[model samples]
Structures are given as C-alpha cells and as structure tokens.
Target chain A: MSDLSPAALSPGGTIGILGGGQLGRMIALAAGPLGLDCHVFCPDPDSPAFRVAARHTVAEYTDTEALKAFAESVDVVTYEFENVPAETLELIAPHAPIRPGAKSLAVSQDRLSERRFLAEIGVPTAAHARVDGEDDIVAGLETTGAPAILKTRRFGYDGKGQTTVRDASDAERAFAAIGGQPAILEERIDFRIECSVVVARSEDGQAVVYDIAENRHENHILKISRVPADIEPRTAQEAAEIGIKTADALGHVGVVAVELFVVGSGDDERLIANEIAPRVHNSGHWTQDGTAASQFENHVRAVAGWPLVAPHRHFDVEMENLIGHDVDRWPDLVAEAGAHLHLYGKRDVRPGRKMGHVNRVRPRER
Target chain B: MSDLSPAALSPGGTIGILGGGQLGRMIALAAGPLGLDCHVFCPDPDSPAFRVAARHTVAEYTDTEALKAFAESVDVVTYEFENVPAETLELIAPHAPIRPGAKSLAVSQDRLSERRFLAEIGVPTAAHARVDGEDDIVAGLETTGAPAILKTRRFGYDGKGQTTVRDASDAERAFAAIGGQPAILEERIDFRIECSVVVARSEDGQAVVYDIAENRHENHILKISRVPADIEPRTAQEAAEIGIKTADALGHVGVVAVELFVVGSGDDERLIANEIAPRVHNSGHWTQDGTAASQFENHVRAVAGWPLVAPHRHFDVEMENLIGHDVDRWPDLVAEAGAHLHLYGKRDVRPGRKMGHVNRVRPRER
Candidate 1:
C-alpha cells in the first residue's frame, strides 16, 4: 500500500463509507468540514449515514455491480463497522484502496482467530480454546475451566452470540444456546475495570491515541464512558502501547479501538486485550465534544491519507448513551446548561437501540 | 403561515434555501440528517452552498418563474442571509411557507428601517436620523454630529457600503462615495463591548435564547466570540429580552440574532440595539461544538415547526474565524486537541474571506 499527501487529495475527493448507521453518518458529518465528499453504501434505505452523504447506493454489500460502481466513484473506502465481509472487501479493493484492510476484518470477524492473532503478536489474552462440537466443548471447559465465556466465532456484538458458562453442568446448555456453531471458550479473567484506548494510524505509520476511557455497561450495552479514565498513568500508557502494537500488527489505517481489561492488584496493573474494533467504537464517543479532534474526524483524516492529529483532552469528560426511552429526555438534556447532546436523528427508538449521547465536561475545581 | 410538524415532513420534501453561501451549505448539511432534501435558489452557481445542496436554481432573484418553481417544489423555504428582495419574497410567499419570514427581512435588510422598527417597539437604539442623499447629509450630521457613521440604508455588510464621517468635510465625501443613496446617519456612541444574542422561535410562539455572546471584530469581520459573555445577570436578561422582542416584532419563525452594543458605566449598564440579523450570525458559530443544541439544529427545528430546543452552554467557548490565510494554520489547529476546527469547504482563500473557524473551550478556572 502507498501513502498520499493530504493536500494532494484536496477537499473534493470522495470517500466511500460502508455501513450506513449513525457511525457512518457521523463520519460523513466530520468529513464535511474537511472538504471531502462521502458516498455511503448500505442495503437499508433508512440508514442514517445516507442522510448526510453526497451520494448513496441502496444495495446489499454482496451486490458486486453496485459495489463496483461505489468503489469507482470514491478515492478510498472505509467502513463504520467491523462486520464487513471478506468478499465485499475483495470486490472494493481491486477498484479502490480499503483501509484497516482485509487482515483486520479476518482477525476481528472471528473470536478464535482474534485471540489466536493476539497471542501470536505476543499480546496477553485469556486462556482460550476452540469448541467445534459437544465433545470439543467438554474438552474446552476442562482446559479453560469453568466460569468461562463461550462465544460464537463470528457476528457477535454488544454481548450477543455468547453464553456464560459458570459451571461444567452449563456446557451443553451453553453449547446448545449458541446453536453448536464454531465457538471459543475463554477463562473469565477477573478485572478491576474495563478500559479502552482509541487509536488512529495513517497509512504511513504515524499513529495517535486518545486518553484511556473507563466504560460501564448495562445489559451488554454501553451506558457511560469517562475519559482520562480514573486510572494510573502507567496503565493508560500501557493501554495505548497495546493499541499501537495491535494496529501495527494488523497494518491498520484509520481509527481503531482496542478494548482492554485492566486487571490485578496495586503496582501490578496489567491489561489483557479483549477486542479490536476496526472502526470507531462507541466508547470513544467522548471525542466529539471533549477533545479537539473527534474520532470521526480522525478516522476521516486517516482514510483520506492525511496526517494523524494528536488527540487532546479539553476537560475531564463523562459521556452517557441515550438508549431506548432515554431519548425522550432530549428536551431536559437540551435545557441542562453545560451538557452537549447529540441525537442521531433516528426516528424509531426501539429497545436496546442507540438513540444518541450526551457529553458533559466536568469543570476543573479551581 | 401554517406550521408543519417534523412527522409531517418526509425524505423527499424539498427545502428552499434563500441564500447561496456557507450557511446555506451547513443548513443543507443539517437538512440531510432529517431526511429532508434541499433545493438552493441562488444566483451564483459558484456559490459555496451549491456544492452540498441537492438541487439549485442559478437565476437572478428577480426571476419570478425560477423562484416560483423553487418555492413550488419545496415544502418550506428558509434563508441564509437577511437581504432577500421584497419581490423575491412576494414571488415565493403564495407558493410555499417562508420562514424567519419576509417581515423580518424587510426590517433587517435596511439599517434605517431596522432602527425605526426597534425604536418604535420601545427598544433602545443609538440616536439616528435618515439621510436621503447629500442634501440631507449635512442636516443629518448636525443632528447626530461628527464621529457618526454614514451608512447606505441597504446592501451593506462587513463595513462595506458605508464610511465613517469623522468630521463635516469627511461627511461630504462619505455622502458622495455612496452615490447619494438613501442612508442612515447614526451617532457612533462609545460602547464598552460588542455582544449578540441568538434566539430561535417556533410558529407556536415558543422562543429560547442562547447565552449572550461577547464579540470582537477586526477589519469589519468577526475575529473572535466568547460565550457566557462577562456581563451582569441583569444585562444578560436584557439581552434575551431584546432578542425575544425583536423576534416577536419581526414575526420570525427561525433563528435570529440581535447584535447590541453595551454602553454606560457601572450600575447603569445599558444595551443599544445595533442591528438585527434574520439568520444565524457568525457570533453563534461556537454553539456548534460548545452548546447542547447547535444553532443549526434549532433553526431546523423552528422552520420544521418542531418544538424549539432550549440552548445550553457546555463550556466557556471562544470562536476564532479562520479568515483568508488564517486557514493555512489548519494543521496546527487540527493538532491542538481542544480546538474544534470547521472549514467552510470553500475553494478559494481570498483576503478578508471567511474560510473557516476554530472553537476552543478553555477549562473553567476557579
């Protein structure tokens, strides 16, 4: 792959975005001020990303003709999510460059592979084993022990496609729950807190990482994320190091979020790699208002072959996601002084849906 | 005019934007998020707004058929600037709803008329007199005196179409320079500071104002704006009142800005209405990143007939315009973590041109 100068690309160049969700919508929004045009491709007509894009193709990712047309029109291709198919990437790649490349998709698409890839790169992860059938499940439980999680190898998100195995007796039920798909069983390592580092890398290898973020989840959905993450500076540094190493290993370009479990006793803080999101993650939403350059803008910059902008913290920040009925509080949120509210312009507020978020900068005590 | 609820508008509904500039592009940008289409009617195809808008009519404002076609296709019409022609308003009025309506434009388009309207409504304004031509110039100066400003009644902006009549002889030259057009002579009252209030009102008569903005200008162009303008509580209240009263008098149904000059000494702080902008003003640009609800969103809400969102400030914000070559520092601005850089996506960087801006939020010091 080759790198292009930012100025050479100019503002009129088109960037292709896959997955027309709020993330894609935000990427398009961020791209606007940079003088870049975005073309969003998604099967759904109601995709939020479609609203802001200069052009959109309403076709399945598997539709090669439409995909070819989209790729030809754009200077480069990027995605808003990690679930992009290898074939879709292969189709787009021959026409225009795809960033965070297919290698990232291959590694992140499957749980077993991602863990194996992490271990191969000398990144610490939980003890894990693959389970193909009932017999394999028994062996995996024996090796990884009980109190481990059994997750399907692909298409799992927000705690979906996974089952918790607390005891040996839960093996069959867990196996049956996942419909006996190819799965991975990992030891449920105890961790004091869940933290993530959002890092962006340009094609030329320059990388920038935001401050570590501490995240809280409810029912497998993110609830709140605080930046500068109430953690030791060493832990934050290590988390960023892990993120950079992971990005380098995957030859990733564009923004990627690496979720980590900060574990162990005092003076022994260690981070275990949990997952690598090849695109901007929900936990990094704080960047929109709390930091100088947002993850969205940085992602656009990276994919456009621009220089990586160093992220800075404007204030200690807290971001809360508005889930389901939470969106109804927009009026109240709007009235609250010093609260930055962002609605995705999503009409349907279904259960577990991400409607919007609010970032409040905590004023430093004088 | 009748109001249309958010639910009443659909994806294909055309929105007619009155001016062809960066603000129109931004409004068009926001319109896409709501799934509403945009049709920009401006005489300049080279208009920056044309790049992002879906459709455009590049015809003279006086082209009745062009305006009619534009108005007929759109559900509602809004404007980027307050200087629309009376005939242009008449051309579209019977066809579609024009928001921040024609009445507001009539008052704001002419300096003398705006002052008269404000003064008639018992709103405080600097002492002034109308000057029809060079003959009345002397007498008008006699009433307002030296150090007054001689300004053409219409088509003036960024200090253009006007001159400072510092003395009697200067007043004569100023009158001749304006080609003796009808103009306004106003006493250049000493002001402590320049500030503006941005307010949005719905057709249902609900209105909300953002924090008072203290502004600084260089060469007639806004240079920087700070929110939570260091002012007494009473002055802030008065500023909001001025905005509300101005909006009400204009029968405005969209975002409006009331720029005022703070005069007088301690314990007697007084506000003198300077001008009315029937569209979003440059002083409100900080709201995009520093407020809970952006002025753009509020304007959309107002024109869409939705409930106006209450404006909320997130941080003490300073917005600095990236005028002309100032945008050359975008790399540094982008690298500065706390600065939110917004480039207008304009192609050229002419002197005195508003290329973009950066909003920096400083930590609230104790």
Candidate 2:
C-alpha cells in the first residue's frame, strides 16, 4: 500500500488539524481534491470541520493521549488557529511533524513575543511597550503616549482581550478590563486602510504571496476583504516582502498572514505591521474565489511538502464575512449573480461568530 | 441548534449519498462550503468519498437495514452513479426524498428505457432495438442493421457490458460477448465529435445548462473533455436544450448529463442523444475551474431545494483524466501553472480506473 511516490500526488496521507473551525473546514475541503485526507482534532463536538474531515477526535487540546494517538495516525499536522497550547504541541511533536512549527506559534500566540519578533526581522510596527505591573503601564504609556491601546499580550484576537487606554491615568482601568493579564501598550496608528498579505511558504523556503486584501472590520471582526487593495503599487510589493520575510524568518511551512495598516497617502504611504496569523487568515479568504488556487490549497501543498502554485488572480473580488445572523441572507446572496457563497456549517447564530463568507467578483480591469 | 433558515444558507443538514466514488467525494466537498453535511453510503470500506463525507455506512446496497438507517438519518438523498439498484432506491425512497428520483434511475439504469424516454421527449437517438434472447437478436439486428453495438440494458458503464457487432454473422457473437444479458442493439452512427451537455434542474423545475463539452475517449473510457466544443453556436444551443429537456423530463432535482454525438458539417450538423448520466458527470469536471459554481455545487444546490446559480464560464478549459499510473505524474501536473488537478485518494493504480483529472485553463477568447 505504501507507494513511494513523489510529492506531486501529496502521498495520499491524512492531515491532522488541531482546530476544527471554518479555517480547518476549508483546509480539509481543499485537501480532499488533492488526495489528502484530514483528521480534525477539536474539542468542540459541533465543530463544522468535523463534517468535511475524513476522521475526527473530540478531545481537549491538553489531552495528551488523544493528541498522541491522532498525531501518530497522520502523515503531517497543521493548524487552523494559533492558540494550540504549547504543551499539547510538545506532546504531539515527536510523533508527527507540525508545520509552521512551535516557534511560529510561540511568537504569534503572544503579542509581546510577536512584536519582538517583528522588530528582530526589521519590520516596522506601531510604537509599543510591554506592561506587566502598574509602574510598567505608566512607563509604557510614557513611551507609546496616552490614548494607546492596552492589550493582553496573550490570547488576544478579533479585538477581544484589549481595551483603549484614554491616558496614563486610565491605563490601570484598561488593564483591569482585560482581567489584569500580562499586557502591552501600543500606539495605534491612524491608517488610511487595513490590508493583509497572505503568503504560503514551503519547507524548502520557497514562497508564493497572494495579492494584498484591503479589509474592513465591524466590532473588531473582519467584515469585508477586497482584493487589488486600494494601495500604491510599492506598498503592496512591500507588504508582500514583509509576509515573505516573516515566514522565512520563522521557517514557516504553510500559509502565514500579516495584517498591515496602510498609514499614509501617495509617496508617503508606508505599512505598519499589526499582527501575524500563523495560519490561513480571513483576509486571504478572497483568494478562494479570486484566484485559481486558494490559501487553503497552498497550505495543504506546503504542509505535504509538495510544490506550491503561483496562482494567477482571474478576478477582482470583494469577500464579505457572514457574521452570525448575516448568514440568513444566504438566499439573497446565492441568488445574486457572480456572488460566490461559502457557509462554514456553524449552526449557531452567535452575534459575532463568523458563519460564512460570500465573495463577489467582477472582471479585472486591465 | 436547529435554526430555521432559507434555502440560501443551505439549512445545514446531512446529504445522504448512495455511492462513494470521486464524484460523491467532490459533491461532499462542494456541499461543505455551502454548509451542508454529507453522509456517504458505499459498500467499499476504502471509498474515496468517505474521507470528505460527515458520516458513512460501509454496507452493501442489498443491506436493507443499513439503507433504511442511512436514509432516515439524512434530510435528502442523491447518488453519484446510475447503477444504484432498483431495490436499493425502493428501500430508501420511503425514508428520504431522492433527488433525480427513482424514475430517473429506472430510465438511466436501462439503455432501452433511456432510449424510449429520449424518444418520448422528442429528442434524436441512434437507431436501437431490444434483445432479450437469441431470436430477438436476429430480429433486432435486422431493424438496426449491421455494424451495431450490443449493450446490456443494466449495469453497464466505462465500456463494460457491451460489444460491437460487425454484421449479421457477428450479431450472435456480440450478444454472447455481453454474456447474453437483456440488451439493446444501437446502430453505429458515424460521428464527427462526441460532446455532452451537463444541466442541473431544481425541484421547482428551473434548469441551467452548461456549454457543450467535447469528449475524446480511449478504449471506450473518457480520456479528455474540453469546453467550447468544436461545434457551431446553434448546435451548442441545441445541445443545451436537449440537456434541459432531458433533465426536466426525468424530473431531475440534481445534475443530469446528456451525451451527444454530433454528425455532419456546418449547417447540416445534428445531434443524437448517446447516453444520460443521472448525476454529476465526469465530462462536467471542467466546471470546477472554468466556472464560479461547479456541477457538484449545482447538484448540491438543486438537491437542497435551493435556487441554482446560472454559472458563467470564466475560462476556456481542457480537462484530461488521470487514469491509473497516469496519476504518478502528479509532480508535473502540480507544477503546471495553468493546470488545476484533482486526485481521488484511491490507493491502488488499477488500469483504466479514474485516479483524478486536471483542468487546464486559459483566458477565454472573445
């Protein structure tokens, strides 16, 4: 049964995904056509990814026995989100090769570490300082200025675990708002637009970067991502460079996304790195309908040690996330011509939960 | 969790599939993005569809208990192939609403009934006659004449269960070749090209037809299928009409593929209905990359009782099947820039077995 074939066919193995969310579901869906089966290991029994994956084990990330059994059964492991506990990964690491490795997770999982890593890579970021104690908060505010954002360094996402520090005096209250966790104070840049560069990196260091997607947020959750970002050509190129450089620095295999804030206009337009998602990010979801290949497919390719495709974008697209009750508009979306709808199969209608996305495309203007 | 939603969001339920091949797998893959779960039922323990489907029952079609249990579990039922037995459909019909119906299966499962159905719909078909025994062979041969093909009325696909009769003397020999099963003798129509019109029809009777795809075969098995078939515009329009008419007449609630044989040149060109695949056909695989919504997606749409999209072809596509060892060239196929490859996770490389397909796309010429 073991056919010693090359990476072209993806070796027909099972990809064990750590998180079974929409990202994991999309990845499994892409992996299927490539002859790779996915075994989704998520604690959530109602996880949408479990439907599409070949197999699944419902156990907490901290369950060593379950993690070891799952890791041993698959060829390689990849994740949909970065908050996969360090101990869980450590338990599985010796049994299976985890792509975009532990270091990428360690860095992205913590804001302070992520910011430090960005600085080491020479990527420009918002002015920031770490805050552990009350004195540190005052000291960080002195550097970042009042009205900076106070964010918990760990487990912050979708604008959660963060609050605005109105002033040095208000920093303590903002810190307590995030449960007084270890945090960072960062000077928030006033940017023209938010955009993301999603790049897939192979284990061999080869990379392919997707066009930057200009994003819009509602309640700190991504609402819309449009490609052919409204940015000067140089900024897009620089953003792509940042994505590639960051992935290469982390020895990243699979898709890594860098969210950038376009801070200026015309020649003065420069990008400030905001965050790095160590997996396929929402902004790159546009690629699923805009290009010949998607970030999910590229992630599967990189994770399988296969060749990554340089996909050509065939259309200018606008991808709108179907948050909560927004999925109920699916009928109108499905009926609309040129609208590509993707529902994540999440049955719940939690107010901020991502239910799906619809990508509306128009012919690219040459 | 049971949120009552419109057809637009797909309502998130399990789609019971009656077969577990690449087609079923692709259907499940498409259904996932629409938030529909698939429960594939196949006797093959190593079925490719099992990997993507939410749940699977590896029990034979003759297993009535399993069929009942499977059918009762899903909201609706559909199949990948036409060979799903009459008794199996009868068993499932009571438990779930079957898309493309038992009647479509009955007609397609038998070549004679299929010919009659086409005739009743005012569609052109090659001259054919039924042969149940030796006496009927000579009589049917007399009507169809020399140089005809003897096909068993049931269980025939991929060039199986049929043989060509050279002349009157060869009629009995050809009949014997097919193991003397109840058969239909079809007059060999000299064809300029072989093409297919893949159409999806909703439960409400709305239909959308794809552009005719010209197919090339090797050893009676499909080798290549290219869109924008080498036919006149009027012929393509007529082929699409045939597809719509056939699907509507069969009361189809999913994709139905109508194979056509084009005869003669220019103004004199005409089509003869060759075969009807009452499911997502292999020839329609190009839609995965050539159009926004695929045949599988359309099938998913129809079966879910949702509104189907009128998909516009975005590229000129050429689809080549990866049969058996041809899949071993995955490296080159994966590396090919314009090529979109799909590999069914069938571990063995059996000769003539469809391993996967690749659709190469280029900018559509105006």
Predicted structure with the largest DockQ when compared to the true one = 2
The residue-level lDDT of candidate 2 at B341 comes to 89
Candidate 2 lDDT over residue span B130-209, tens digit each: 88876776777777878788899999988999888887777678878999899998888999999999999988888998
lDDT of 1 at A70: 96
Top-lDDT structure, candidate number: 2
Q: List the residue pairs that clash in candidate 2.
A: A331-B8
Q: TM-score of each candidate?
A: 0.83, 0.97
User: DockQ of every model listed?
Assistant: 0.23, 0.55
Candidate 1: residue A201 Cα off by (Å): 3.1
lDDT of 1 by residue, B279-328 (tens): 98899988987765678878876786666657767678999998999987
- Candidate 1: share of reference interface contacts reproduced: 0.18
TM-score of chain B of each: 0.94, 0.96
Q: List the residue pairs that clash in candidate 1.
A: A292-B337
Q: Which stretches of candidate 2 lie over 4 Å from their true place?
A: A1-9, B1-10
